[model samples]
Target: MRASVKRRTKTQQDVQPETADVAEDVSDRIRATLAKAISEGALKPGSKILEDAIADHFGVSRTVVRGALGILEHDHLLERKRNRGSFVAAPSIEQAKELFEARRTMERLILELALGRASDADCDRLNAIIDREDAIHHGTDEKAKAELSGEFHIELARISGNGVLTELLEKVVARLALVMTLYEHEHHDDCGTDHHRAILDAVREKDLKRALHLMDEHLADVEGRVRLTQDHGDRHTFEAMLASFSPQ
Candidate 1:
């Protein structure tokens, strides 16, 4: 009788379902999928994400979709208007500047901390990521490479062993990816392989100052390459007609 009671108790404990916990997991899965799509450029900037459509596609209720989208909106990956539906965010010029500025500041501090705390195992993991990146780089799809590029910066914060810092850097990198998707004229590789390799070498050598300097230059070089003045206007018949009146 005692053994049977113990067995029954264990079984009940194992089978128990936390309804709230399950709902949260569903929402998290939805948010991660959508965020990946946006970061990979599969979902274009300013694209509308209809809750009904998402709910249908994911086989979830509208409530679940809403919860997921709320997280994305908080992360600045989506914007929810009062009357209008949620749309993928398109960072404006000023927002782009602020994003990059914040990224540089946060990432520099992260690297400084990582320099102090990263163990041999942590550094090895970073190297492995770069190796995977190299394999992806040689592949045909630039979009995959682009996603990895944003991840590299976030990965550094993870190596720092600071959860709060990692979360902050993750959001910063996501916004930066959106900025690049909107404003970059041509999509090249996200980060220069040589640049990444050099930074890793510095970290391994325990040259914190050199690592920091390289990171600063690498970021500045990337930002300088972006022409913030590039027009993002849609092609229209009116513009085409007006262009025909040019003196040329």
Candidate 2:
């Protein structure tokens, strides 16, 4: 009887850490899914996140959902109220202006540095991303295309060979996605591939001045299209929005 009890106790103890790991895995998966949804515009700014419904959808406890949302809140992707739960962050027009200004500064530096160091291989990699963008347009994945749009900028930062700049640009780019969510109009979600190709070609030809000018023009074009003084709302529940992303 004593031996049997000891074996059962050990089994329960072994299961405890495994259970905690599973909970953490659930939290991470939820965080990534929510982040991607926000970036892709499926989860628009100011949308309320129903914790209970999300918990139910993922078959996890409310505690797990809270953990995931807490991570997003830390990233500024979500905001929590004292009694009202979490909602997607909605930046004001002032905040949007600030983000774009900062992006312009960072991207100029990024492009300048990348131009100085770009090898033939780097140009090839950038062209591949553009090719992928073209393919995404012909396919049926708007979200992928939007994500690639953001990635193109980040990739430029990466090729600049500045890790600190890359890190800063990543945060700025993420916040800019939220700005786009609040202000972008129909058919204005991308920084046209042609603009990207033009910049890449200038870099390949070692035309520093022209590349810098094109970068400025491209960012100006993007900022010009956003409606800074407009109302923003979307009529989709959190679960319903996420459900659309799920496979049949």
Candidate 3:
């Protein structure tokens, strides 16, 4: 009986790590899918994040969904209310201004670094990123296209060869998605590649002054779209938000 008990205990121990690993992996998938949906405007700001809905959709436990939601909360992508639940973050107008201010400050340094360090090939890669996003059909690949709206700046940051800067800017842009979704008026798309192309054009010509001016203006334009307060005209159900979500 002692030998049998030892064997059973060892089997359970061996299975525990594998079970934990699978749960963590599923949590990551759940997190990534929801993040992209949020960034793409499929998941509107201030929508309650239903842990049960997500768990049911992903065929995972509420524990796993909470793990994902916790990471999003850390990033300010989700806000947890006392006894209520998590909801998508809806930044106030003041918070929106601060976010843009920080973005302007960071992007200036990024453009400066990019101008000094970016190679001709880096310019081409930037062009490719822009073109690829442009090619996506508005109806067919709308999800991918919208999610990629802010990627041009990220690509440039990568060219600057500063991993830390790139990572920080990514977080900032993700949070900005919340701002844009909550505050912008209907029919306003801020990340139009027109601004991206113009900025890259200046960078390629090594015109740092022009590049900085254009980037500042671009950031300004996006910030200008925010109203102090507005009805959330596009909020969707939790079931709808998870409907198109696929594991990534």
Candidate 4:
């Protein structure tokens, strides 16, 4: 009987790590799912986030869902309104402008840093990201194109070798994704690729001034594509808003 009890104890010990891992997996999945919702426009600006619905959809408890929502709220993707529950964040035209301006500044700094510090392998990685962006541009997937464009910028930030700056850039990029969904006027081809290539070339040549200028021009082009206005007519309904929260 004692041997059987010992065997049971061993089994419980072996299962503890797996249980902890499963808990972590759930938390990560929640974050990723909500992030995708925000990115894809399923969670539109000002749409209510039903905790119970998310819990049911993901087959997790509300506690886990709340934790996930809390993280997104911290990230500025979700906002809690007094007595109105959590809703997807809505950026006004002025807000969007401010966000883009901040993005421009951060990205230019990241480019300057990257030019100074990027290793050969980092450059290669950036090139690979560019290739992926190009492929997405040529492909028929519009959503993929938008996502890849954002990722290209994030990859550049990563190559800059500044963790704090990278984190800031990631937040800016997430906000940009929302802006692109709401305000993009045209599906311009090449997506500032020549500018990226120019920046990369300048970096490879170790020309910091030229790289910074190229980055400025690229950001200007991006900002020029947005047509922000007060008219959010079609995106104002609950169902319409909820649809926006999900992936496109």
Candidate 5:
């Protein structure tokens, strides 16, 4: 009987690792689903995430759901509030300014690095992305345009052959998505593709000066579209009537 009891104990211990692995896989799937939703703008900024509902819908434990939400929070895709559940992060105007400033600096550096390292084939890859960016007309969802526009910058970072810069740009671009959603003027037109084409043309010609100049103007145009003026509010008013426009 003592031998049988010993065997039972060992069996239970052996099962633990498998159970843990299953839980981890479930957690990763949950994290990926939530991340994609946030990326695609299905979950808009300032929108609350219902943890219990997610657990129930996925047939998983709340612990697993929390684990997934924790990862998203780390990515700045979701913000967890004390005594409140997780919500999609909404960047304030101040945060928006900082993100754009950082992106402008990062992008210029990324361009310089990419120009030095990129092959003729790499330049062609960029042209292909621009081709895709121009494939759809204005009738499509604006989010699609933004997604492709973002891919352009991310591809550029990847071409720089620097993993650190790639990671940083990815995070900054993720946050910038939230910023654009919250603060862009209704009539603001995105002009990313044209600028990208010109920059790529300069790159292929090895004209770094022209490429850099075009990049600066492109960054300015992007930042100029966001309404960054101070407004009266408890946190953010979001009153369209009271919204101020940036200089044209």
Candidate 6:
């Protein structure tokens, strides 16, 4: 009878749905926090991820933190090791080049399609996004500017009216933002203004060829701005982690 009671207690403990739900909740929160950090450039590339520190910071169990880390690993934000703990992702120079090349190809295609398909309303919306980006750029908040700059491209993709291409562009833009944050040496002053204006003007003019050409130039400029040196040091992860503490 004693053995049966113990077995039943163990089974009940193992089958607790509430415990699983709570664990999932913690995992989501941790993942969001880390993702925000990466987006903000606080947790830079190659930074070490200490699970215990995150668990302590969030007041959650290490199990929950591990789950979150696993998700981030899948997202290519965090990397794991056999014995050592997880670390933030650091994109190589070759990877960064490949990412930009992909963006250039994909963005040109998007613009080529959008040149004729995008309505006046779509142009207006794109203009509005650029305005917001300008405000964010001039504001004292650098992180907000960074986020808005990335968002501007995503907004353009949405206006292109192709769901499949938009999704692909979203992922590409996210990776580009990560690369820019990790590898850029100097910030571009006209990051959001000139290229967007050119693209919008070409779209408004309904000149598909000109629009595509302008997009190529815009992407080339952006690619050129990134300083991709072969430094495999662990600074990226640390910087990304620090970026999460901003007011955003």
Q: Of the candidates shown, which would achieve the greatest TM-score relative to the real structure?
A: 3
Cα-based lDDT at residue 104, candidate 3: 94
lDDT agreement with native, every candidate: 0.79, 0.83, 0.82, 0.78, 0.80, 0.76
Which regions of candidate 5 fall more than 4 Å away from where they truly are? 1-15, 138-143, 186-191, 230-248
The Cα RMSD of model 3 versus the native structure comes to: 4.9
TM-score of each: 0.83, 0.81, 0.84, 0.82, 0.83, 0.77
Clashes of 5: 0
Q: Model 2 — TM-score against the truth?
A: 0.81
- Per-residue lDDT tens digits for candidate 2, residues 180-228, read 7667654553457788999999999989999999999989888876778
Any idea what lDDT model 1 has?
Answer: 0.79
lDDT of model 2 at position 22: 94
Candidate 1: 10-residue stretch with minimal lDDT: 232-241
Per-residue lDDT, model 3, residue 175, is 87
Tell me the lDDT of model 2 at 205: 96
The residue ranges of model 1 lying beyond 4 angstroms of the native Cα positions read 1-17, 233-248
- Candidate 5 C-alpha lDDT tens digits along 148-247: 6478888889999999999999889888877766666633434577998999998888788898999999888887766765442222435422343344
Residue-level lDDT of model 4, residues 106-160, one tens digit each, is 8888888888888898888878878787777788986675456467678888888
Q: Is candidate 1 or candidate 2 better by lDDT?
A: 2
> Candidate 1 lDDT, tens digit per residue, 1-248?
99999999988776666656677888988999898888877776767788898898878789989999998999999999888989888787789899889988987898898888888888888888888788888888776675685666777888888899898888878777778766765556636667778888888888999999999998987777555753742222234335545777
Which residue pairs in candidate 2 have backbone atoms (N, alpha carbon, C) closer than 3 angstroms, thus clashing? none
Lowest summed lDDT across 10 adjacent residues in model 5 is found at: 232-241
**Which candidate, 2 or 5, has the higher TM-score?**
5
Off by over 4 Å in 2: 1-14, 138-141, 230-248
- The global Cα lDDT (0 to 1) of model 3 is 0.82
The model with the greater TM-score, 2 or 6, is 2
List candidate 3 segments past 4 Å from native. Answer: 1-6, 137-141, 229-248
Ranking by TM-score: 3, 1, 5, 4, 2, 6
